[model samples]
Target: MRKVLITGAAGFLGSHLCDRFIKEGFHVIGMDNLITGDIKNIEHLFKLKQFEFYNHDVTKFVHVPGKLDYILHFASPASPIDYLKIPIQTLKVGSLGTHNLLGLAKEKGSRILIASTSEVYGDPLVHPQSEEYYGNVNTIGPRGVYDEAKRFQESITMAYHTYHGLDTRIARIFNTYGPRMRLNDGRVVPAFIGQALRGENLTIFGNGLQTRSFCYIDDQVEGIYKLLFSDYVYPVNIGNPDEITIKEFAEEVVRLTGTDQKVIYKPLPTDDPLQRQPDISKAKEILGWEPKIGRSEGMKLTLDYFKAFSKEELRKSEHRDFV
Candidate 1:
């Protein structure tokens, strides 16, 4: 059996990746700090003989014994709310955490894949951002902590590849959503779903004109797995290209939830991108991967998860009232 290490193994994407590897019969070692990631995500995996969980932060030196075949570095503050609250940790994980993982990969002669985000193309000047776009980011802005850190992550990853000739893959992931997403993470999908379930207004920033392309989690995970095992070295975009305005997304969520929530517009945050989409021509040609799930289907799955939570909460409240 091949040995694989996954950082941030308790996170939404990391957990799913862990499951994927484990199901494939790989001896998977999962490492996480439990700072932003929750244990519940990987608790069930502990019973599996092929899975091992470690409560270690990757920003420090990562010392995993034995030869590893693959390392998937998915550690970082992925959500905007997470990076905003813990800027230094976010930067350190992307920088120091990435460095440590790259060193480990070199030592073990293992193929490594790092999770790079589309945030690198900050407030992009291009409509559909390809990997070649240089980006139009303000390094000093409030969102710069996450953007700059990812940019540096890519830089260091390429340096390692060029200087050491290590096999490396980078996936420039776009907005992804599904179950296991934190309801209060301040991401648009979860935030809208949570609000609609509670009969609260769905808040839209800046006249609800800003657009985003969301990829379902399963499709995102499949794309990443293909890139990791493939012989691709350069960054590949993995996301759905279906673009929709914030207003349209909110309406869809409300419709799916069967909620009568009002849409409330608020001023946009600083450095919020007006448009975001991924050009996956390279991905299509190289990896033969494209998102298979549509937004409507994806939203229905997400809403079902949230609905379960809403019912649980309501049951608890009613019990208290009866008491």
Candidate 2:
């Protein structure tokens, strides 16, 4: 069986990747620090002899025995709430963590994929962001910790690819939503659903006009899977291009949950992107990948998953202890 090392294997995206690889008959070595990742996301694979896990921080060093065919570097605090609370750790994961993985990949002659984000576009000046568009970013902003981390991650990955002749792929992931997402992660989808389920009003920031394009988790995983195998070395945007405003999405959530929750507005967080939509031309042209799941279909599945949470679970997840 082909062996692969997946960092952040317990995260929403990473867990799904683990499942996909396991399905494809790969011996998967999963690693995470459990800082923002929940082991529960990948606990199902514990029974499988092919799935091995390590509860270690990638920022220090990464050592995996045997041959590694691929390495997916997905270890980083991905959300605003998590990164803001632990800025240094977030930076280290993207920079130092990524560096360690690149070295490991070099040593093992493994193909490595780095998880880049749309946030690298940074409140993008371009509508429907394409991979070529250099982003307009506030380096000193609160959100820079996460954004810059991703940017640096991409740069280093490319450097290794050119300098060391490492096989590398970079997926510029956009906003994705689905099962296993943390309610209190402060991302829009889970936050809205959590509020509605808790009988609380859904909160909107920045006048609700700020737009985002949400890709479903399954589609996202598929895109990443395809990218990993494809020979493309540059970044490819993996996200649904269907864009919606924050206010409109809140209404959709209320309808989906069959709740009579009100929508409340709050000040927009600093450096929040007003518009985010991916131009997936490269993904389509190269990997022949585009999101097959529409928002309605995807949202229903996601909502159903969150609806399974007990009231106590919902209550406790109402606020994440950032500390």
Candidate 3:
């Protein structure tokens, strides 16, 4: 059997990736510092012989004993609320943590795929963000902490590939939702579901006019998996291209959850994108991948998953440690 190491193994995305890899029959090594990642997300795999976990931060040092064939570097505080509170840690992980993983990949002769994000576009001047467009970003803005960090992450990864000949892939992941997502993660999808479950009004920022595209978790994992094995060494945008306004998406959530609640509005955060969508032409042409799930189908599945959690479980909590 082949071997793989997954950082951020206990996060929403990381946990799902673990399930996929284990399903593929790889001996999976799961690592996280439990800073932002909850141990509960991955505890189910503890009894499995093919799965072993490490409570270690990738920003410091990463050591995986024996043969390793692949590294999926998904270890970062991804949400807006997350990166804002833990800006320095976010920068460190994207820079230092990524560097550590790249070095480990070189030592192990493993192909590595690091998770990038749509935030790199930084309130994109272009519509339906493609891989080639240089983003419109404010380096000193409040959100720049996450945006520039990912920008730097891409820079160093590409450098390693060019200078050191390390096998590398970068995935520009988009908004993905499904089970195991933190109800309080502050993203629109889960936040709406959590509010609906708790009988609270759905909160929409910025008059709900801004646009975004969301991808289902299964489709996202499939895209990343294909990108990992593909010969395309450049960055690939792996997300659904279906775009919708925040207001429309909120209405869908209210309808799906059968909640008769008023939609509330608030001022949007600084540096938040006015429009966001992925131009997946390269992913389709090169990887033979496009999102197979539609918004209604994906939303229903996600709402059902969130419905499983009790109102008490959906209650808001203070932000804890930074990863």
Candidate 4:
């Protein structure tokens, strides 16, 4: 069986990747520091004969016991709430942690894929961001920690690819939501859903005009998988291009949850992107991929998952980094 090691294997995205790879008959080794990642996201896989886990922080060093065919470095504090609270750790994981993983891939001769985010395009001057667009990022802003770290990550990955000839893939993921997402991750999705569940008004920042394109988790996973296996070594925007404003998206969540609550407005966070939509021409042309799951269908599955959370969890104002 082919062997693959996945970092952040307890995160929403990483755990799903584990399930996908294991289904494809690979011996999947999972690793996470349990900082922002909850083991519950992956506890089900602990008993599988094909699965093994490491509870080490990738920022230090990563050592897998056996030969590996692939490495998916999905281990970072992805959400704003998590990254802002632990900014240094976020920077380290993206910079030092990525460096460590790249070294590991070199030693094992493994193909490595790093998870890059749309935040790298921070408060974009472009409408729909494509791979070639140089981003307009605020290096001194509060949100810069996450954005710059990823930018540095992409830089180093490309350097390794160009200089040392490493087999690398970078997936510039856009906003994605689904099962296993933390209720208080401070993204629009869970915040709206939790408010609807707990009988509170959904809060929108900046007049609810700021837009985002949300890719369903399954579609995001499929696109990442396709990118990993494809020969394309450059970055690919792997997300749904279906864009919606914050106001409309909140309404959808309320409608799906059968809630009567209204939406309340708040001040927008500093450096928050006004618009985020991916131009996935490369994803379509190269990987032959575009998102298949629509928001309505995806929201129902996500709603069911959030509904399963214990009542205690639902009552909390925010659940990030407190687990």
- The C-alpha TM-scores of every prediction are 0.96, 0.98, 0.97, 0.97
lDDT of 1 at 226: 94
Better of 1 and 3 by TM-score: 3
> How well does candidate 2 score on lDDT at residue 236?
95
Q: Write the per-residue lDDT of candidate 1 for residues 104-150, one digit (tens) a residue.
A: 99999999999999999999999999999989888999889999999
Q: Clash pairs of candidate 4?
A: none
Off by over 4 Å in 1: 310-323
Clashing pairs in 1: none
Measured by TM-score, the strongest candidate is 2
Best by lDDT: 2
Query: Taking the tens digit of each residue's C-alpha lDDT, what string does model 3 give over 1-323?
Result: 99999999999999999999999999999999987898889999999999999999899988889999999999999888888889999999999999999999999999999999998998999998999988999999988988999999999999999999999999999989988888777787888887778888888888788999999999999999999999988999999999999999889888988889999887778878899999999999999999998988988898888777755576653122111
The Cα local distance difference test for each model comes to 0.90, 0.94, 0.90, 0.92
* Residue 261 in candidate 4, Cα distance off native in Å: 0.5
- Model 2 C-alpha lDDT per residue in residues 1-323, reported as the tens digit of each score: 99999999999999999999999999999999999999999999999999999999999978888899999999999988899989999999999999999999999999999999999999898888999998988988999998999999999999999999999999999999999999999999999999999999888886999899999999999999999999999999999999999989999999999999999877788888899999999999999999999999999999999989999999999963221
**lDDT of candidate 1 at residue 137, scale 0 to 100:** 88
Worst 10 residues of 3 by lDDT: 314-323
The RMSD of every model to the true structure, in order and in angstroms, is 4.2, 1.5, 2.3, 1.9
| Model 3 per-residue lDDT at 290 | 95
